[model samples]
Target: MIPHAALQTAADRFGTPLYVYDASELDAALGRVRSAFGGAQVYYAMKANPNLTLLRRMHAAGVGFECVSGGEIARAEEVGASGDRVLVNGPAKLPGEYAAGARLGATFVVDREEEVGLLPPGSRALVRVNPALAVSTHDHLATGAAGSKFGVTPAQAPGVLRALRDAGHTALGLHVHIGSAIRDAADFSAAFARLAELHPAVSDLDVLDVGGGWGVGADLPGIAREARAAASVFGAELWVEPGRYLVAQAGTLLTRVVGQKRTGRPFLLTDAGMTELLRPMLYGAEHPVTALWEGEPAGTWDVAGPACESGDLLARDVLLPAPVPGGLLAIGEAGAYGASMSSTYLTRPRPAEALWEGGEWRPIRRRETPQDVWAMEQGLE
Candidate 1:
């Protein structure tokens, strides 16, 4: 967690509607993963927060990348990760994406049976197995649940692996990513069980990737035990992809109270909206909001953004101090998908991002200007 004072300082230095990340928290998260799963390869899922500076930090720490698109692969390559250091994963990969992966000799994850023929000749690959179990996460986050359009069924994984080998590609083994922000470790246990059952049909596997979706404060040691047990079925190497688990708590979104509203419920209007942070509106995610101004507890309040849309609320029913126009409010747990998912909808420029390292605040991404937003649409001639 970033210190409240640091968040306020960042807001003052960078301006409100800013994102602040703590380098110490990022390192600590990686340390936790390394300690929990000893000897297992760790891949930072780049989709969570693909800031180039952050990528370089992960690369310096000797962590690999799990990328889902050609652009993401390029980001990984920007930091000198290629070949075995990159794991390419996506259900519907495009032709250009395949070319990008081929150039780097990246390890492709075959999500569907038909993907077997799409790989470059002599490519190394893993078959993604959808255990098809019910997981306790939001519907949009449950990528491995039944009817989810993610991976091949567990029964289809063996055939896909064989097809990869027959097509002259190196068949690494099986991969299973049940979902994101999965709280129930039992969900992972069941998914691993389904993969272990395939050992009889899928033998001599080299890797068993249990894709990361561990919730904050999840029992990682217990989950690692189950993962190791499943990997032992084929004596394969254990690999994990951690995304939000490593960054969620390390980020803070700083926005200012612009005014107050009294529509049926009390609301504190803010300068930032869905364009700055979309998780609260998109996934019903509730981020803890901290008021910077000192005041006695006013009462429960809803935080609204500049958007006219009623669904643009950042937080609801938050017990907060009385609103002071221009008072700062820090939205917590935004390190993962906050800026990565930000958009320019309604022509609102994206917010700036900064990093707190070595007791100093440094700008990582500058705030966009209105001119910058419209530059692409202007005629170059």
Candidate 2:
């Protein structure tokens, strides 16, 4: 657990609507993953939280990265994570993106038949298969289900692999990501079981890339055990790319209460809004919101952000102390998608990011100024 004092200090120095990541917490999560999956390749999906501070630390710890876009790949490379330490996995990679991966000697998780054209001849790659497995997660997050736009179907794998071979690429593995925020061990275990069943048919199946979708407080031990057993059966190299699991619990979003209202139920508005953290509005994500001081539950309050939309609520019917303006509140479990998915919607400037390392707060991503936000549109009018 992060010292609340550290969070207070960060807000005191940086200001509200700030993100503070605990480096020690992140390291501990990575350590646990390493110990659990011995000899298996663990890739940090940089999409969750691409802060350079965190990326550099993971690189130093010898953790590989899985990039969904060219930008993420660049972020990983910027932190000195190179070939074999990086894998590019995107269905719609840009023209030179695969070339960039090739230059970095990064493995590609080919999602489409045409994407194979981007890789050079004889380069080893993994083909992502869509098993149409209906995972017990949000419909929007279930990627492996049929009709999703993520990967090729199992039926198409042989053809895709043949195309890759025809184009002189080596199909070394098969990958599957049923969905995100999946808590049931059975979902992961089943996905692995399905892949294990498909292994013998794949002539060059030397690796299995079971994508990560573990939720907070998920069944990790059971999932690991299942993964090990499945890997043992195929004797294939195991790879799990987890983004949220490693960082979600390590961050807190500090926002200051700017306004308070009472209409039967309490309404507390903060400077942070959907533009800063869209998970609530975007995915109905729930994070425990707590006031800085300890207090008894006053009543169920509506916590909303400063966004113009009525949907910009951080949470609803949440128990908190009496609504008070000019007070501070920290949203927990915000270490993953909070900052990474942030946008300058409504022209709001992006928040500053800080990392708590060695018991001190250090600025990682500086807050954007109005000029910084308008720089791109300068001279247009």
Candidate 3:
């Protein structure tokens, strides 16, 4: 749902290879999740973007914050997030991260025994269970598989839950993030179904966190059914931590087609590459690539960026109209991991981020200058 006019305005003002986010689209997605999950407790995963403006909007919308690091916790605090509404979660948590969360009274989603040791003596916490169940999505996003580093085993979780209780920690509930980019509701159903079976083991549970991995046009009805079922069995509330599902469709990566030529086959090189968005090469992720300008006759083209790596491609075998040297390409569904996963590789400065709010384009993060990239080196000299 990238508005062409708004995107065009953003491009003209902020230049090419910019990140544009629609606040209305993001709010609509949050509304859908709230309605679809029957008003489940939603914790916006800040690791997805961590834009302070967006975080403030989410906080004002009554959504909690799920942080993975001390920096994220500070972001939540800066955005006025409630301590009780914050969750600290990750596989490898530093002592500082736990201390920061503990200072705010944020709950910890403990993934391991060492993580459990990070929490306070009588703090409320949830144990993440690695059900070893794979979702029907990309392998890289699957977190519930046997060798996954996401959570503790289902059998081992109960013992840990008891140990936490014995050590005077209040075991709030259980968490299972199967993976991201989940397309079907049955995949979620199966995981929660398994967790439902394991509910008897996790004693004194108050919440059932069937973590979020919803894809574009995911099955909300089926997910609600399974989530309701799991909650019914445990007699607890359902909580979800949706990252991509709530943000992906609301974002568009506006990149200018630098040059178009046929080297055996037509290759459309763009200004944006792995440095701006790494999904295509990193996870084989696909998104709708549309021409923001006029169209001509249709032809097959391979879309690549200016990255040094050969795998820096946004799409391949795509049929698009004639492309000029200065044409713009709108990469859809880039709201979630797009900017967050970006790196300053090849000494390229990261792209700027803008939010479409109040029917106006507001620049959230400014584009980095060349000096910003090599400033560390300058100090050494």
Best model number under TM-score: 1
Please, what are the lDDT tens digits per residue for candidate 2 over residues 80-123?
88778898987788867777787788888999887777776667
Ranked candidates (lDDT, high to low): 1, 3, 2
lDDT of each: 0.91, 0.85, 0.86
lDDT of 3 by residue, 11-118 (tens): 989997999998889999998998888878999888788889888888888999999988999999898885778999999888888778888889899898666666
Preferred candidate (lDDT higher): 1 or 3: 1
Rank by TM-score (best first): 1, 3, 2
- Candidate 1 off by > 4 Å: none
Q: Give, for candidate 3, the lowest lDDT window spanning 10 residues.
A: 113-122
- Residue pairs in clash, model 2: 122-168
Error of 2 at 331 (Å): 0.3
TM-score of each: 0.98, 0.96, 0.96
Q: What lDDT is reached at residue 53 by model 1?
A: 91
How far in Å is the alpha carbon of 86 misplaced in model 1? Answer: 0.2
Backbone clash pairs for candidate 1 read: none
Best by lDDT: 1
Assess the local accuracy of residue 177 in candidate 1 as a C-alpha lDDT between 0 and 100. Answer: 96
